[model samples]
Target: MENEKTGEVLRVASDEERDQAIIDAGFIPGWIGEGGLRPEPLHDFEPDTWNWETGRALLEAAATSINPRVAERRNIRMANSAAEKRTSLNTIHCSYQMVAPGEFARAHRHTINAGRFILESKGAFTTLEGKKVFMEPNDIILTPNWLWHGLGNENLEAPAFWIDFLDDPLVAALKTIFFEVRDEDYKEMPIKEGSHHHIRWRDLDLQLEDLVPDPNGRYGKRLQLQTPSIPTMRLYIERFDKHMTVNPVKSTANHLFICAEGSGTTKVEDKTFNWQRGDVIAVPSWKLFNHRASINATLLEITDQPVIEALGWYRETTV
Candidate 1:
């Protein structure tokens, strides 16, 4: 007989000997042994580190990964996250949203605030409320908490890619986080052009001749084109002539300004920062500021004031 331990010829063991060997190995015997021995618990655990480069690679992989049949059935083409799993508390969920030409992601909204940055495709715009802002590669769109919005691909041959960021912790903490599919699937309104009913990039470049300045000493023309009741607020691009100035806005939330064309300087508090096209600047909460654009300049400004007002936290002062 071959020995099981050494693979050498040996005599076969009897049942009694086998039982003896098991006892010698310090293991409980089956059926009639003393109470089973307990093993040590593995209590100490460590989590993996989060890396930016790894996150980028993982996102890219997910963007190109094939969708499983089950996912396809549910319209889940690609679902991935910065965390290892969707349930992980320490990770950020990043899903790759790819809409084929002429497809839509359906209108939806959640308690979590989200922002989407375009990675590819043209002729697609996100309609927030009634405003349809055309998207370009690297264009960042903000989807504030509880705002109804949708994305539509107008191009016939290009796929659109976007990176979505959400307030994951807040959603998970409140347990009120959810996404809803609207009955209409998409907003029923047509895309408005040239600031007729919506604010467009081109319309922002025109002069502010129609804006009548306030008699109350407010600097920039205080025309109430879009009000907080409208759900979203937007401002067009135009240069502030050499001496023309804007009064500081003292508000609870911050303001986001994107330089779409030309160069300029923004005075925030006592600091002045120069800005140019593609530059995004955030005016911190409760700060006093004004901007001066060089030559022929244009800017796109989006702020959280309207959203804050809806929540009853908006405050402002004029200087």
Candidate 2:
């Protein structure tokens, strides 16, 4: 028998091998043998179930059936997420998240375009663009590139859950996905309470009235709500509830939309697609499209138009 820990070796009968000798000495074999297999890498188990198109569809469908009121008061938990191949394109990332009553997710921001759709929660909320909008289970929120945002529980008794999406490829491509923490735990400064920078669900309708038809024929109806001058745009619930407007966007960059409430249809080129709460639609660069709501709806739309314009690559046309 041999005691490796104490550097002592004892000779046993030639007929007894290492295994038998250890048993005779009342000691267990703790070391792994040479023939044992090693563990596999995590990339080997990457997700095979989701693609960009399918993932977006599944998220939209799930959001439509969620109960906002209950989610607000109760808590929900998110399951593990699987990755998709299209992730290589546009450096996009997607995941699901759920939270229960009394649980809170930390506030954060990055240089990517981050979008979220409430999966469940009645009184949950997302503070973006300086406004705290109650996150009805199906509502959608947008955290544009380099913006500060946070989530909260409005109803003390309810839970909340939502999905997160980011243009990871763009950030990775640019090699600039920097994140910073605020000293106050939240970035509640730099914006005024009643300023245009802050927008709520109620502000949707008021903002829509400000949309004027396109003076040039480049778009059926074009309203540059936000630009480099503003840096952000807000479409409140009221504006989404009004008559569906068809505005053509001549794209130089990708167009992103987050459904806040209700359902709608979008005409992309020659095709029309139905959209509901929590749906995140991404129109690729240089595409022509128009949006219509079935009923009153609220939506937060964003785009890389600023990036294109800055690079002198933006152009739009309307017929």
Candidate 3:
């Protein structure tokens, strides 16, 4: 397996070697001892960014070379390889996905929850269970854990692309990863010609004006989108007005933020990075950070708070 972060190849000469490697990585038959210390540090202190330009170039190349090789799937993830994902302490996975015209991503269900933020699409839709959910630019779609879902691009002249986010790390840690593919393609039933009422994540439209200011006044105006389909996670859209700066606060859980619109500068402790639309930023657990927008900015924030909070291990403090 190719390790993206270190550019190293991990060779597995035999099944025994692979199983031993998996066990050495902190699991025994899919179970980790409750009090055993991890061999690896769970998180990275320095934040990193995945530039949109690089991602697009990779995706375009993948659409040609990689898309055809995999059956009903073509994706480039932001993490390392399958064995070592460095995206976050929680192992949140983000990827750029593409499906050529008339192509289909085979129907499958998994124990790990997932979501998609459609960046570009034309006549693209996903079938979750038996309902057809249309994809439009900026539309967010939910594919909850254990739900049978598949993707398709029906437009003849164009391909569709989107950002895929999943809580695979958490599932891997729990050793509860489960996946199954359907034997046949999921047929989309006909719907009212213009109705978009079946779009699950689109159920609530974002209205910035309707949001009350954050009580802490740390983050500027904010709107939290609850994806009931994936009840274990929460998503937020944070808005920063021109010249506005957010107060520093320690993160209670790992967060992956994508600049959906405008430009800004984020400071994680002493390190800072300038970000614009399409750039992704990862904030590992316990990092103190804040941001200032050069212009009005909007970010899509995904976090592992649901799992952390459930475990009663989440914490945060604002100065």
lDDT of 3: 0.74
Candidates ranked, most accurate by TM-score first: 3, 2, 1
Residue 21 of model 2, lDDT score = 72
Query: Per-prediction TM-score, please?
Result: 0.44, 0.52, 0.78
Candidate 3 per-residue lDDT over residues 102-171, each given as its tens digit: 7777778899998888777898988777556778877777788898777788888888888888888778
Model 3 misplaced regions, further than 4 Å: 1-46, 68-72, 80-89, 183-188, 191-206
- Which candidate ranks first by lDDT, i.e. highest? 3
lDDT against the true structure, each candidate: 0.51, 0.51, 0.74
Off by over 4 Å in 1: 1-107, 111-122, 127-149, 154-177, 181-197, 201-207, 212-218, 221-223, 227-239, 242-253, 306-319
- Winner of 1 and 3 under lDDT: 3
RMSD of model 3 against the true structure? 10.3
Least accurate 10 contiguous residues by lDDT in model 2? 41-50
Which tens-of-lDDT digit does each residue in 205-252 have in candidate 1? Answer: 333656554455444443233323334343333444444555666665
TM-score of 3: 0.78
